[model samples]
Target: MSECCCGEKDIYLPELATITRMQHMNETELFLHLELDSGKELGHMPGQFVEVSVAGIGEAPISNTSSPTKSGFDLVVRKIGRVTNAIHAMKEGDKLGIRGPLGHGYPLEDMKGKDLVFICGGIGLVPQRSLINYVLDKPEDFGKVAILFGAASFEQRLYQDQLARWAQNDKVQLLETIDKPHPEWSGNVGVVTTIMNQIDIDLANAISLICGPPIMYKFVIMSLEQANVSNENIFVNLERRMKCGVGKCGHCQINHHYACQSGPVFRYSDLSDIPEAI
Candidate 1:
């Protein structure tokens, strides 16, 4: 295989990566830690995803759940299809093929010194965690940080220990809720949007990042607009639309824009002309 000038192989070819750890976060989700066999870091920024493959099972695009500042990369895979099912069956010492740190990432440089409000629902938190950790790791580079997460129920929550830690950290403010009430849960009991009322940021100087089910976008954007947060200051992660990490497949197209190429992350204002996007 011919190597690119960056010393990596062709983007279409999968490089071998070894799984270093695996943890079951819930009944359907598996958290994995991997390192490239080439002994080099994945060198991914927050919000980029990688294409993972098993020998006969096919490939799927999975987001990097960890920040680039960390030693190894992480992914939280939901057992929904053949590729992910095969991934869940893997063990700690197992190996898989990785193709990228693909797609455009969040605009971290522009976000410096601006307050951030992260809103996530269900498994959408997987990709958002990357940027969350990146900002937390360098608190002085940013302003206030707030995270609001909603799950179907308390039992469906991912990264319980980390959530607990973020809750305890004075530098971060976290609010978690569920769609419906559970006997063991005494915290907020409502959809993710319900907690927006509790946010206390300076809307004029704040930026909001949202990632969740397709259905949640409209209402969340409405809530943000009602609160007077500018569309230019709002961003969304559409990583779920990615099929082929490279733009050739056309699966992630929204009108003339290729989400995988131009963005898995986009400023809300830029998508105004693309009705199908959101």
Candidate 2:
């Protein structure tokens, strides 16, 4: 096994992790809490992803949904593909192969002392939640934090209990909206960007982190630009088609950049020149 600078084993070799908890968040999403068999931490940063493998079903790249500061790790898997479907069939005590904590994560060190704005849509909130909780865990390490979350409907929302708790935290300002009004919903009704105006932060200086559908990026960037947030201050998590977390495969290549290696999380300014990136 290859060794990293910290003397950890190769990232390509899958490690055994047992599911400590499993819950269905919605119709398609499954939340899993895992602990390594070696009794060691996953040592993952906020936006990093792991390659989860089922016995004969192969592996898929999944973003870590829990913060590094937290024990073990978490993942929210969407049942959209074969590998993910196999993962969904797993039980609380089942073991799976984990091959990462891969790729670059969000720049938390740079974000220190800066006002933060997190814009998340649908299941995209899964990855962004890691950083959100990281910041919230140490409120004194950062400035003001505002979270703007948008879901398709009341049934599509993830982490309902956690969202309510975040809303109650004095360190955070949380605003949630649905795409359309439902009989059971009385919250704001509109697209995620529609509620961007409700965020009260120093737009020009605050660092904005966005994660969601591909379509949401264009419009959300536009909204941030309109508010005068510079591209340098805006980071986006682009967890695209990353087949190999080590970047040997070209599946996640965008122009000269590889999402699996150079990204998955990048400053908007660094990706501005790459038309295929956004």
Candidate 3:
């Protein structure tokens, strides 16, 4: 009923975003697409996340995989804890609170004209998909592009339809693998790091952005280094508990850096000294 900071009138303050779509992508993963009455675009950059709240149940930080250009956005969530379990029970059109498209996103400006290599693992592919689809929309703005994705198993792959389209792009080199294989799967079978063996990188001109669990980041960075990519050119997305999307909540801090504000996306150069980043 009042004017908002952006000079907009009567925005829904995020609490009114009725869940328009909700589905289970896997046994452990749930996808929620909310349509807020705010009528304001998320206006977020790729690699960012949002804080979702379900009344008395509490809240959790979930990465946004759908590009900002997409109608609303998509959150690929894996329920491992309490708050997530409540989120899983929600049905379409259920109301929930959403704050942000928070945290720094990928270095898209720096990516212009650079050969971009995306190394995504597990649910890590969610954030990577945002940057991937964005880059594809502006093809000539980049140089040689490649995507190397790995997951725990064939059954856990996310966004299989879009992955197929990316594979069809002549200018993009797409390679995907899984640690364990299924009978119908014909792709490589090993950790995602194994795909590194199939591509040649000009470390001087190449940049890699990776997302995954702690162990995956450890080994992937090692592989990228062996391929000669400088530590400075490597970026990562760090996820920690986040309550407030803003800096007020102490949950997302890692020492002096607030993962909600300063990251969720960060270059290795800035993180090289932060052991917790591992």
Candidate 4:
């Protein structure tokens, strides 16, 4: 019953998603906790994203940072453009237009009982955190767990609070690095690939999930290859500009496949020929 950023309303229109709480992680980044007007729990899988619209402004895709097991979800919005900036200006109780929990999520069911290695970089952790939390909730279902994460600088780190907690847990291995190290820091410095060199993985039973900027892929994949991890065992999430969350929009297409539908999450072997994809 609230106004949307977009004036248009119909089946293509979005339902109301009210901001319940807000956390300002940094200047440009904010995490919004949203509850639906339908009063039904927002059910979505890890790696899926929602199209958020500000009334009379526009809509942009934002990935879910919270676990699917929860009643509500959290969105980490980066205020880099118009629509996002409009969303950033909104406050708690503001109703934003939400289109979907679109895109195919990671196939976590297939990963059960396998040693899971998560390689995340910067804001890539947004979606990756979902899988991480799912695994943490049912740690006994999987084998050894390791998370190798990196950020540009100390201030650029995402989910610092969770990272700190992860670093302390004994059941899993957590290694983090920043490109530019500060004097107060003593942790690993350099790229996340450096963590690959130190961890001992069972190549036969372990699988690695990679998510990050395009530049991080080649190097990370190369590192995984060096470690004898098979291409089939490696999965990746590819990002594309999506206008429509469904396959009807050509914006997210990569050759024959649609990143919004067929992927966003894919086995590396499935993308062996997609050059643009990393």
Cα lDDT tens digits, model 2, 54-83, are 979988999999999899999999999999
Tell me the tens digit of each residue's lDDT in model 4 across 91-147: 999999898888888888889889889899888888888888878878888788888
Better of 1 and 3 by lDDT: 1
> TM-score for all predictions?
0.95, 0.96, 0.90, 0.93
Runs in model 4 deviating more than 4 A are: 1-11
Candidate 2 regions off by >4 Å? 1-11
lDDT of 1 by residue, 112-202 (tens): 9999999999998999999999999998999988999999988898889989888887778898999989989999999999998888787
lDDT order, best first, reads 2, 1, 4, 3
Question: Tens digits of per-residue lDDT for model 3 on 150-269?
Answer: 989878887787788998997788889989979989989999888887765565578898998878999999988887779889999988876776788688788888998899999998
Error of 3 at 239 (Å): 1.2
lDDT of 1: 0.90
TM-score for candidate 3? 0.90
Model 3: how far residue 10 lies from native, Å = 15
User: Which pairs in model 3 have colliding backbones?
Assistant: none
Show pairs that collide, candidate 1: none
Give the C-alpha lDDT of model 3: 0.82
